[model samples]
Target: MHQNPGGLSAAEIHTERKEQQRRRRNSLLLVVPILLFLFFAFVAPISSMLHRSIYNPTLVELIPDTINALSSWDRTGTPKPETLRTFSIELQQLAKQRESGRLASAVNRSYPGATSLINATARKLRNVDPNQLAQTGHLALLDTDPRWSETKLWQAIDRLGAKYRIDNYLTALDLERDAQGNIQKRQSSNIYIDLYSKTLSMSLIITLLCIALGYPVAYCLAHAPARIAGVLLVMVLLPFWTSFLVRTTAWIALLQTNGVINSVLQSVGIIHQPLELLYTPLATILAMTHILLPFMILPLYSVMKGIDPSHVKAALSLGSPPFSAFVRVYLPQTVPGLSAGSLLVFITAVGYYIIPALVGGTEGQMISNIIAYHMQQSNNWGLASALGSLLLAVIVILYWLYDRLVGASNLKLS
Candidate 1:
């Protein structure tokens, strides 16, 4: 064995390294469960959602032969008789599998009212033999349904037959691909952009309101005596104990036209008539601000509590005015807290679903509401996923901007 100047043998050094490696392996083993849980619970779902946004496999999976045949033909002219025969054969298989509805639904998403035409053709061809279908050409199929010759139907099929596409993302952005495979703005009323803008605007307003309301409360909590601060902290945390749904319902009851706020105002002779308060943008902003206020206060208070009062006092003793000392010396120290709290509140507000749904009327509904509508009501999971991905991208971009401008490293809880 080799010996070192410190009298450590090579074998002893090897054994020590092995021991360290063993400890590290054991430590890593302890965290494996957490890592697996995070991957399955968070990462897997997000990845699946993103994939769903771009994956369009229903048509290709059901009718591969038809799609393969159509791929060779120039899309400008009418589909040849051989292509029609191939599609008829595939339609027979699709009906045999009882998946005509699935294909029809998928096609209808691209071309409205296509489900009926496809279903009718499938029904007419259900019992026809494959040999008979081959013998009869495109003209016989056209006799069954004139739509068989229509370019729109074939184009819709070609559009829906892709295994993977960006149609969902384009639709989410209120855009579409033309027949020439060129991107174009949709002719329909564009609503997603409006909803997205509204979501961001409302979130910003709520963040500002939270900051305005939370800064003073946080200042008081941070500077108060121990007993007072403890009481104040409990008061701030009291909202957490209540359920979110319950709090939202309470706000609705208080903000309704004949609810507590209007009743109190009328009783005090402030207004002669009850004002409409429930189901408005004002109600949404107010409820969201209240719900998210504690988030802002807690972070601000944590950072402010650690600030040294002596620094501000020293500035005042140096003949600086109290307001100037505060603006110049003390305010700058709170930047970290402000950034942390504002980011927290803004992100949380952007994803809020329940409060807005309960209190927000037509004018106040947010993009999250639209996402939910597509997922649950319209049965448009692809569109929902695309919208969700877009929202996630926006958040990531905002975080990158915040990191660049405000320096995320400067953000602190305490």
Candidate 2:
């Protein structure tokens, strides 16, 4: 071993090669568990959800014969008896598999006539032995039901069975389809679109309010003495230390008819009435602004803190107006923080549920409320998923747009 100090002997060279191979093998072994974890935990769930979104399980697997056979017919016209026969057989198989409910449910979503489609097929199936499903006479047995001759019924079945559709998207938009694939908005007076609009509008309003209030506060904190800044920052962070629900509940009590704000206002003769503040849009905006103000303040403070004080001093030395110097020199530097804070607050506010549910009126309730409604009140997973997916899409697009706009501006500056 001592003789191999300057150069590797054959045994030493082999040992070094073995050590390198062991490291490579260990690294590969380490990577495998991480990749497997990502696949199982993150990737698999997302793939499953996306699959569920387009998952038309009832028709595709059950009625393959009918879907394949009806490739040429117009939905508005009558279909031949052979098509009905194909559907009838598929329905019988589906019933045997205990999947007829899914078929009926899917058909009910697309067309009213198919309410009895599955039941009719099931009844016919009951009358005959399982071996007789292939017999020609089974077709006549199905023809007894008027749904068997309905072209739109078969079309709906085929769609629910075969199509990877935008129907869920339309439904989230409070729209639907007709027999000819034409889209129409829902005529219901109460719907998801209203909730969606309210959500966006409320979020935007809250974001603007946060910026207006938080900007000055953050500016003061940024330019203050270090001790003062520390105190203000501690105050800003204090809410975060408290439980979110506790803060929201505190707001509920404070905004109530006999609560502190109303009591003080009445004592000062500002208004005689409590003014319905607790369950109004004002309460939602106020509470959300209070809760989200720190989000706006911290980012703005970070940006403002990094700014050179001499920039404004230089502008002032050049005979620029104080306000003008501040606007010209100070405001542009804060864009990064402003954009960051707005994006954070808006994204969080849009998906807000608990705060709005507690303080928002019927008029102020957001889309998340409706999603929760469908999940808890209605137990309609498809509708809820459609809404959830749409909300997620909206957030994604908004973030993308924010990134592009901010990135472009940053590029121009550089």
> Per-model C-alpha lDDT, please?
0.89, 0.80
Clashes of each: 0, 1
Scored by lDDT, model 1 comes in at: 0.89
Q: Which candidate is the best by lDDT?
A: 1
lDDT of 2: 0.80
lDDT of 2 at 302: 94
RMSD of every candidate to native, in Å, equals 2.4, 5.1
Q: Candidate 2: which pairs clash?
A: 59-161
Error of 2 at 294 (Å): 1.3
Q: Which lDDT value does model 1 have at 301?
A: 97
Please give the range of 10 consecutive residues that has the lowest summed lDDT in model 2: 133-142
Best candidate, TM-score-wise? Answer: 1
